[model samples]
Target chain A: MSYMISKATSVNKALDEAVPLCEPVLKIREAMRYTLLSGGKRVRPMLCLAACELVGGQDSTAMPAACAVEMIHASSLIQDDLPCMDDDSFRRGKPTNHKVFGEDIAVLTADALIALAVKKLVTSTYFGVSPERVLRAVLEMAKAVGTEGLVAGQAADLAGEPMSLEEDKAGLEHLEFIHIHKTAALLEAAAVIGAIIGGGSDEEIERLRRYARCIGLVFQVVDDVLDVTKSSEELGKTAGKDLIAGKLTNPRVMGVEKRGNIFKGLIQTRWFR
Target chain B: MSYMISKATSVNKALDEAVPLCEPVLKIREAMRYTLLSGGKRVRPMLCLAACELVGGQDSTAMPAACAVEMIHASSLIQDDLPCMDDDSFRRGKPTNHKVFGEDIAVLTADALIALAVKKLVTSTYFGVSPERVLRAVLEMAKAVGTEGLVAGQAADLAGEPMSLEEDKAGLEHLEFIHIHKTAALLEAAAVIGAIIGGGSDEEIERLRRYARCIGLVFQVVDDVLDVTKSSEELGKTAGKDLIAGKLTNPRVMGVEKRGNIFKGLIQTRWFR
Candidate 1:
């Protein structure tokens, strides 16, 4: 628990320095800082930092990337809450970015964060990591965010109802697709980038990649369960949105008990052993 | 003219290949393909290629980055035409992206293009450019797209009435600020990246950077004039949008004739000489 706290603390500090409020464009910067520095669990950054340290890389070498993953996450959250997208009013117990910053600024904020995220990773070379690894990590991060990753998942999620009604094998595949691309891909990329930057061998990187993928799926499944079981106040965002919107989720398609068992089974089978 | 045709031809072919409209997320892919393949003048790619060749870099080496500049440009256009932004119905004589794809997909299209642009530059190593150079080019592109560039420009452009009211020196400064960041930065980055990829010396890269900056500003100023002088049929977009939106353009700040002379003077003094 202390280790996690230390990692989150450093990640927050790095994020603050990365996106200073004092800027040539103060309003947009405020919007960016509002969303980015808003406290989440910092799970993605912790994964990135842990993977780097596990592979013998110094924290400084990976700190920029850890911050970058969080930036991407923030960008995604802002976009997801936009009126045209998920249309949620709140996130992390506060008004969504679009609600606070207005729609235009909110849209630009997401874009700026994405550009800043890529810039953060590319400039990470100053820490003495090889340019080749940095380039690879950039490619990985891009793929995780682009069509093959989050974009695809979000699109699928938005094209709800038709697919959600199918409780067959195809529905399971669709659900898995959404979870993997929308949630797991960034998590997987975070760990993979950390390992690559930390001088891990190809074998080690692949192992970490697999581990992170499972964890990402597990994370989404748990989130799905929480959306079903918790209230809006408890969850810090609008809960039961998935059910109300008729969006597909593990609990919805496979039953809450079954989904919980699957989550438990994966955890015990993969991590404990 | 033939040289321009050749460069644009190769760029078109490369762009088609880079964004293949295949399965998985067919809708998003279609939206991406629609905007990306839609005909533009291809000026940015031409400048990127010209800069590369001038620095003795092969076309093959810089084609990916050249395509990347266009992708970023396309992303900006999509976002610029959003209902909350410019709110234009027509772009390049066709319906804007959001008009065709709906707002949700349109937003995702811009995002996917950005990630793809970064991906394209990062994977340019296959053309044998050093990873160091690739990393540098990526950083340049990111900066051009982020707060210091397009995002900043658009933000200022949106806060229109207040800045537009200041037709004094400060207003001119504001207009220049918007033009440089919104328009010129990407062009400068394009030329700079080309020079870097083509293995130009720092001095050569800096020279191209300056040249591209001037050209980019001239492009916007001319565009502003055309908005006033031409009809929608001639300009291929909603003509007089700047006037209608009260957008701070060159013609709005300075008389059309004065802006025209400035454009003519720049051409005669810079390129012709």
Candidate 2:
């Protein structure tokens, strides 16, 4: 836990410097920072660094790849928070991008951030990384966010919530699937792509992938727990909004108390062992 | 022109085949195919193929890049047809994807098509092309679609309208800029990236870039002309939607009568030269 905390703080500092450089358009960049700079666990970048080290991929290239993951992750969240989408007003314990900058600019900020990620990744002076690897990373990132990944999950989550509840497994089942694609897909990409960028061997990539899948599921499980356990002060966003909105999260479907045991059991599986 | 047509028809047919195979989800794949088969001039893909040929590239890689460009173009058109965006019911003289598939599924289709583009590009089994080159293609596509390219233009366009005619320049000044960024950026990417994949020299890539830029701009100029002078049967989609929206476009700003002279001049400068 201490190690995680220390790593996150270092990442937070890196992000502080990185986000400023992403100011392609001054107005939109301000809106991006408004939401992006808000404190969070910084899990995505941490996963990148962790995966990099696991495969012996320590270098400056890691920062660009790590930052790229964070940028993509940040962009998706901003888009998801749009009024036309989830209509979220806050996230990560602060006002969402749209809430702070209005819908037009907020959405644009998401766009800018995603572009900045690719732009930075491609242009980085990482030797022998090849335009092919960079392109693969870009494509992977796009796939992670596109229909089959995060956005698809959002669509499913939105469509499923109207019909699911305690008495029905169908809604919860859909929501769980949504969570897997939406949040977990990118998290998985963060680790696997990091491993690839860091030039990890194929076996190491797979190990990191398995490890990432475990953590991605855990992160969502934690999110589910926090949605019920955390308050507005703790979450920065509205507390219990997911529950109020009739989401089929783990806590909602499995019951808040049951969630802890399930999370623990899953992480303790043989793979993690 | 006849050669271009033959080239386009063959390219279109290949894209039509490749698109469905890449669809990760069945329904989303069908949704994507529905709009893609609807057809435009296949301008983006043609540019891609043209660049590959210009660079004297091999067939093993060029074919997939051609398909990828069309997919990106198809995805953009679907997004533009959304009720929350352009709100158009017709495209290619037929009902838009949202009208046929419904908005919920329509959004997903666009999302799926975009992802499939990445998948197809990365999954290519070609040589002399590294993963690095493929990754660069992804970044270019993302940069084209993400905030700095198309999205910013779309946002500007959305914000530009609803102002007084006096604000027309401000409103439409950005319209062309948007179309260029949103539309032409990817077209240029299609050309430039295709050359890169083909193993073209840097000089060859630059030459192709110049040619592609001219064509891309001309393509938009012709589109502006078609939206006015042509009928629904001729141009497909709504012929006068551009005029109806009071959006700044070639016919609207330059006057329908003067477009011939202006287009001629534009061609002479950007193309004929």
Local distance difference test values of all predictions, in order: 0.89, 0.72
Candidate 2, residues B16-129, lDDT tens digits: the string is 787554544555667777877876778777777777777787655677877877887887788777776777888887889978866657765665676677667766546557
For model 1, report DockQ: 0.89
Say which candidate scores most in DockQ: 1
Count of clashing residue pairs in every prediction: 0, 18
Q: Write the per-residue lDDT of candidate 1 for residues A1-273, one digit (tens) a residue.
A: 998898899999999999997778888999999999999999998899889999999989999999899999999999999999999999999999999889999999999999899889877789999999999999999999899889989998998674444455777778888988999899999999999989899998989988998898899989999999999999999999988888888877887879857777667754323
Which segments of model 1 are wrong by more than 4 Å? A162-166, A264-273, B162-166, B264-273
Model 2: residue B231 alpha-carbon error in angstroms: 3.3
Estimate, for each residue in B183-220, the C-alpha lDDT of model 1 and write its tens digit.
99998989999899999999998899888988888888
Which regions of candidate 2 are displaced past 4 Å? Answer: A1-27, A100-109, A124-136, A161-176, A268-273, B1-6, B19-24, B101-105, B125-128, B161-176, B264-273
**Each model's TM-score, in the order given?**
0.96, 0.87
